[model samples]
Target chain A: MLDYSALRTVAAVIQTGSFEKAAGLLNVTPSAVSQRVKLIEERLGIVLIVRGSPCTATETGEWLCRHLENVGMLEEELLKQLPTLAAPDEARQRVTLHIATNADSLATWFLTAVANFTKQSHHLVNVAIDDEDHTAEWLQRGRVLAAVTSLEKPIQGCRHLSLGALRYRATASPDFMARHFPDGVTADALVSAPSLLFNQKDRLQARWIRQIIGRELAGPVHWLPSTQSFVDASLAGMGWGMNPELLVGEHLKAGRLVELRTQTPLDIPLYWQMNRLAADRLADLTREVVQTARLLLRHEGR
Target chain B: MLDYSALRTVAAVIQTGSFEKAAGLLNVTPSAVSQRVKLIEERLGIVLIVRGSPCTATETGEWLCRHLENVGMLEEELLKQLPTLAAPDEARQRVTLHIATNADSLATWFLTAVANFTKQSHHLVNVAIDDEDHTAEWLQRGRVLAAVTSLEKPIQGCRHLSLGALRYRATASPDFMARHFPDGVTADALVSAPSLLFNQKDRLQARWIRQIIGRELAGPVHWLPSTQSFVDASLAGMGWGMNPELLVGEHLKAGRLVELRTQTPLDIPLYWQMNRLAADRLADLTREVVQTARLLLRHEGR
Candidate 1:
């Protein structure tokens, strides 16, 4: 068992990539961070960091760091939701409904919903997106009040409503399409193309291709885990990708990206699930999500 | 936003049927429970329950009670796994793995898997069951480190493996078969019979019936939520049910209960999934599950 405070300090140091940076972020001296980390390693009975000029989280350290980050995020979210649980000075009386959502939505329709909450007294937003499937899990853990999920059934103790569908189009940059799919967007050519994915969890484009070709295709695909980079990778002609129409719509109309598949557009119907408590604030947030979903994704089609 | 402590006290009072009994269960005095409930009602801005010699959770109180119980159970598991975080006692040197599992599996194969973990001294087990699908949500929330899920795909950051098939024989007492399936044990008769579900979430019987008859065609059925009661209900001539062979094998052998749909024995394959970092532990556990799954479920095939 590692000392939590020490492990947290080590994690901060690793995340910031420097004890000094971690110390500043923690509002403590650099020596404090170093000492905490050293103490954590001693308690763990394992060397958690390779200490030198620049700190690196060891394999064990990274594991602990990830768990720490996960638990810390949830605990922070719990604190945000439970005002009475907090100290009097730290009390956040406003009911904040945290939701996990994609970056494109965050940049677009999601903010519109956030603005809708500004008229109300209290709200907080923490945007996180890597895999859509796990969003409902966020709701289950009480990390979020509600989530935009891909699943139909609501998690236990929650009620869900279908928001709408998000249509995804497989598009590639003109230059990349020319270089890779020069023979046209034929089944044979797609097999050899260097496609890109948002992350390892993404299989939309691959699933689409399998549906089209009636077989699975393999390629040495690049993984740009960041939202901005994933879209940029598509624009840079590095790979073909199934991107949300909203993200690539402008580029497609400008002829920067060619539609790889025109017939079978993936319509990912989204759902919003929340704890069924008839709280005024949670209800308001759900209404905002429904309104935003109707405007942004309703027209995308099923 | 609900006062959980108040809700829990009310529920304890109902379960025990007395303030003193509830207080003893909670390791608090009757006065303390009374004071807490009063504070909760004052804080919640609602009347929760009618205080008397024996207590009962109100409609709203019951709802909050359920949620509070869920939260408390999850937190207890969390405390057990993170003993260091929960308490100041113990050296806090080992990583504990919490797992959510159904009562039956926990009583049987799940424990066998734990017995195999004796060599690897890096983990502890926290077992609870909400539902199979919801179990992964527990893992997602970090309430549990792993789960035996019906889901084929891995939860985010988790890896999955097949645990082979668990064949369920739709069985009932001879009297039940005679009364419900008077025409015979044909697809049509089975559809019209009072079918038993393990719970609301348990769809094995429905799925089994649907494979033959299509849609819901069953008679008015009783939902016995407990696994043991579900089996007992069928045995008591309540309904036709899809019972695990392990649970009812002896009765079937003794010719006490008769199996229906012999040709279409409902086979539900189990899958084991866990966080990837616990590879060694998962490896040990998976090996045991495969071994136990072989011994427990393998022999029941038609």
Candidate 2:
């Protein structure tokens, strides 16, 4: 069995990007930190860290880090089940749980779920902001324990929980619509109008165009990568864009943004993809996420 | 010669992530957009775009986009040389230039350079914010035409120019330092104290620990990903951190932040890396970036 304390030291080093920082985190001497790492390396017969300006884990080191993180979560679950086993003076360990999520969900309803979880548990949340289409990459790389993704299929060694659908509306400032498409959103008018994009990877605009206009779209495109900035740009009449209903609902209702008429709103289904660990904390987190998502998002079947 | 118009159509589609959007951009019907794409595919006898929710360019498509962008730059240069060749009714096309840069640079002195360039040239600047260590990935993927990186070595098909050094100081709020280390920074005190980090990838804290304490550091770490937030967290007494001289210079002088005495400040050398394109616009941009960097950053080899 691996030494949990040594594994923790190794993880701290990688996370903090230095032996000294890891030593400081573990409340151990620099020599102690070094000794622990050396002991592990000697046992494994392989180099673990590539020391430089900031230290990075080798391939084997990455695997070890992942294992340590998983084991830490399991240990926390064990502590919850058998409170008698916990030493009186031993403080409850705060497991660092890394999660990958999209900007829209983060901006809209995800934070509430996170806030609820943190209030109930002693855990550090490390969130990696990414597009829903791409969050799986973090899980695949073992960079995150869980992710909010658009993909329904589970990654190997992971399970999927369907959250719900996030509805989006193609919207623009009233002044923008008047200036760009004075008559109506026809083929010719669209050619001259500028549109807002979240990023190059964002397909919502294109998908919406196909669904609404039933044609290829052409226009000047402004790429605003940040969610808040994208919304602000849309409000400032930079261009029309697809805005999540939760984010822009108030703006749409208050006449700050005008929704372009379409046959149906674009609904993107989101899923919680997590490692298949039977940890209570993970289960509790999943429950909170599902409950919060259901309260905020449209039912998937609908 | 390849049809430049069709090539532009293809690029717009890829950028906008939809055929309909590309058609809208080209001021053509959806069928026209489809025909242009089909024509290009037939001419090349290879697929260019992989149709999906958001269309992505195939290997051939990426090459074509690069060619078209280069050709567009050359055309602009030609127009500049021979004003008589310019059509009276044809508006000047705004070239899009993608640049990858570190977050610190983007948050500090880079925007001034961009603003200056935009004032003089009709070009749309797309800035991709990444760590200095990782900016080359964007260049390798052809996602960016230029990059601001710390790597001294040039990537294949690219050239590198030394920008300057960005000095960093180990600092914390006065209250934080007193609370954490009542006495001077000893190894035992440092281990128990909390530190603020920019992100998991950030190594400035670790580097500072090694330089200042000459040993491994141990501490509770708070990861704040945003540059502004990282500074705010430090100011809020969350933890000590390595603050950029440019960003925290005023704070240090104003007594808001106390500098931890070390042997010397950490100086990180930066470089401007770009494709070896002979476009005048590219030349102009490089000149502006180099000039601006020299003004803000410490001149290297001085």
Candidate 3:
């Protein structure tokens, strides 16, 4: 077994990026964290870390620390379900949920889903917005109880439920589309046409083109990177690209932009992937999401 | 940010079904884990857990504890990489790398890969064996820094490199194959033939049949969950199913087991996916695995 106290102190130090900051988070003097690491190293007979201005874990030390952390997470999750097993005075009162999500979901219906459950759920959520492709990884790590993912398969011991499809329209301001795709908008024309993307990792545009042309997506595509800018770039007619229907519904209705591909608009089926342990919470959240999807996106033909 | 310390303690209590056991693992008085959880609940303004003989986290509480675990894992991994950032003492040595791998890799080249990284890598490896499909989920929860996964794309902030193919051949004792596959079996005959699998999660038999016959695999397949048992069952003629080439090499050479297909094996391309962060120890370990693959399994073809 590894020395978890030493490990925890070391973790706090890394999180704060300095002994001083770690001390603040831990509510201990910086000297205490320092002394603990020293004693741990001496006892273990090995160097567990490398201290720079920002600090890092040595391979062996990091491996142990990572294991310790996993154990901690598993234990914590188990505790939530079995809190009443502890002594009366020791019974837990509040629960915290950590989730890795995307900015769109975080900013949009995700919070509403939480609100739907909050009346009966006395829990706080720590939402970290990352890419959808990687959100499911958090579930595998035992970090979050649930996640909104593009993946169809569930992680081990977890279950997956389809929420609804997110419809995307390839729209551009009429003037901008005319400026860039002036050659009567052939597939080839749009292939190299300047388009916007959420980030370097975003491949929505290429994916849209592939569906239409029946080939791999390979071409010159511009990256807008940020959600706001992606929408801005499309509205500005800098390029033609897909935009989430919810985000640009009004614009499309007002004719600010023209839908490029009427035949094929990108509609990704979204799924709610979660650990199977918390059956009630998962079911509630799933219901809330499905209900929201039905209310908000039913007309989009999912 | 939640009180991870409290969550860890509470989780331990539940796993061990006793605060005493949890305390022993936590290196604290059972009272400490007990008190910490009480305080955590008070601070959170919610009833997070229910205490009893075997503790259980409430739906709300489990949610939070899971998040705490995730952050704890990432934090632990980071600290291990940069331990000196906390103490900077010359005493700490030996970097650790925790990896969750499959049984075959652990019993075979995984250790060989470990042996290859001698210089600058005094590693403490925590090897976990599970199905390939589920390994990346472990990586996502911040449980391990790297993993051998079936995923083509990398996890968040991680890079994925192909490790070539893992070819599995359906083999059986020559006597067994001769008796079972009389008249040299056709694809359709496989539906009724008994087969072997690594575990309940093992789907190689179904996958292989699907690949060859373009249909679902449904038959009287025997379930030998352990790596050793799976091999033994096939050798004993209990069934014919997919087994790794390395384990079956000698038998194939000795004509003890007959290959089931003309294009007789299923090839699953393996990938070495790791966090993008540079660690001398991890780099050295990766180098060793790559070298071993080149020598042992590279020529099998992807």
Candidate 4:
């Protein structure tokens, strides 16, 4: 049988990113936390942590953390059934849900789902940001219990739900359009103009270009990792970028921003994938996400 | 002498995250690109790229990238002097500069600095996000040519200049304040009210708490990582958070949000640190950053 107390100790270390802080949280000595983790690693014959200035979970550690999350769900349900065993401090009773999503979604509509879920449930959330195409790797590695990703296929131990497509438009300020695309939005002109990229992992602009222009063309690119700043950079005429339709809608309507071409919008399908062990317990969150997606995302024939 | 072609190959691989993609960018075959990288690695006796689904820069890889950034600056100057030797495509002339900054800085004023800089210069930017207190580590680890950081002391080989302080207020929607702090703001109420945290690295809220309340008290926290979403979550009555005064000023004045207390504010001093090697060539960007900071950031007695 797994020792849950020591497992909780391991989770705390990963959560706080230091044995000292975890010790403070659990009211134990730092050495005791370290010793407990070392003992668990020895018993399992696997290294669980990459100890550093900020400790991170290894592959085995992520699996253990996933197991702990399901166990936490079970315990929280029991606490609801028998309220006598709960801690007086609401903080102690609440559990933080670890999830992952793309920055654009988080900037647009993912928060609506998460905020609504938090308001109704006694749970907090820790959202790790990654590119849409890469968040599935987080779920596959067991780093997050659930994720909003671009992958259609489900992982081995997870349930998948279609969340509809996130539509993107190659948007630029009117001034940028006049400066860079005076000859119209063409593959030749695009080779010179700068484009806003989320990061190296972001292929939205490349994918959108290939879809519209029918080929891969390289251009000067500015890397603005923050989603809001990416839009702001586009508005300021620093670069043309693929902005989510949801975020650029008002600006588009107001003519503060304009699309590069009339019919060049790219739609990337998003899906919600979660570990099957926690699927039933996280139904409320899943419902909120699906409902929010239905209301905000682009749907077929809509 | 370092093989400039091979170094460029390493940079291309890191920028594109795959040998095939990098090969396409350089108009070369994938195996040739791979062999060149392998030869350079063998000669250097250090691993540069961590080969993965999406490749990453090893510590030594970061150092090489930094050196390349300095060289890029010199070559851009040479291109200005002699335009006859430049590539026909403007994309080949422009270089991407990697810099690190905190998310709040990026959301508020950092983009303004970068935008103004890019408008005049042909160079592009790539900004990496980390906590302000930790961004200097990026500079130290040779991961970036420059960074915006909170550390006052000078880094070993970098030029450090104060950009001024970014002021933060404990803010929330009126509805949140009423529901969470019914009996006035006290330690007891704070211990029960949920707080907003950016992530585990964010010690701002806790430090703010220590400054105002004079003790360590625990509370429930919702982890919202997006800077814009963090503000929106505050507006939605999710929790009280440390919001940048720049972002919340209009919201505060318009009655969309309010401060938790009358006199509680946290001012984090920010600094711009860059490699001295690139300082002379990047004087234009450094000037724009400092000038923008002077205009937007709060200074002593201001």
Q: Please tell me which predicted candidate would have the highest DockQ against the true structure.
A: 4
**Model 4 over residues A1-302: C-alpha lDDT tens digits?**
99988888898888777888788667789999999999999999999988986788897887898788767778788777888885564326567788999999999999999988888887888889999999998888877889999999988899999999999999999999999999898988998899998888888888888887887777788988888998899999999999999999899999999999976889999999998988988899999999999999989998
Binned by DockQ into CAPRI classes (incorrect, acceptable, medium, high), candidate 2 is incorrect
Given candidate 4, what's the lDDT at residue B96? 70
Residue B245 Cα positional deviation in candidate 3, in Å, after optimal superposition: 63
Q: Is candidate 1 or candidate 2 better by lDDT?
A: 2
Model 4 Cα lDDT, one tens digit per residue, B1-302: 99878988998898878898788778899999999999999999999999986788898887888788777777777777888884565336577788899999999999999998998988888899999989999899877888999999999999989999999999999998898888777887887788888887888887787887886555778888878998999988888999999999999999899999876889999999998877777788899999999999999999
TM-score of 1: 0.38
Give the alpha carbon lDDT tens digit for every residue of A146-175 in model 3. 888878876789887777667778888888
User: Which digits, one per residue and each the tens of the lDDT, describe model 2 over residues A136-178?
Assistant: 9888788888999998988888988889888998888898888
| Candidate 2 structure lDDT | 0.76
Give the candidate number with the greatest lDDT: 4
**How would you encode candidate 2's per-residue C-alpha lDDT over B189-222 as one tens digit per residue?**
7766667666767767767777777865546565
**Model with the higher TM-score, candidate 1 or 2:** 2
**How would the docking of model 1 be graded?**
incorrect
TM-score of each: 0.38, 0.67, 0.43, 0.92
The per-prediction CA RMSD against the true structure, in angstroms, equals 30.2, 7.0, 30.8, 2.9
True contacts kept of 4: 0.61
Best by TM-score: 4
Predictions' DockQ, in order: 0.01, 0.20, 0.01, 0.59
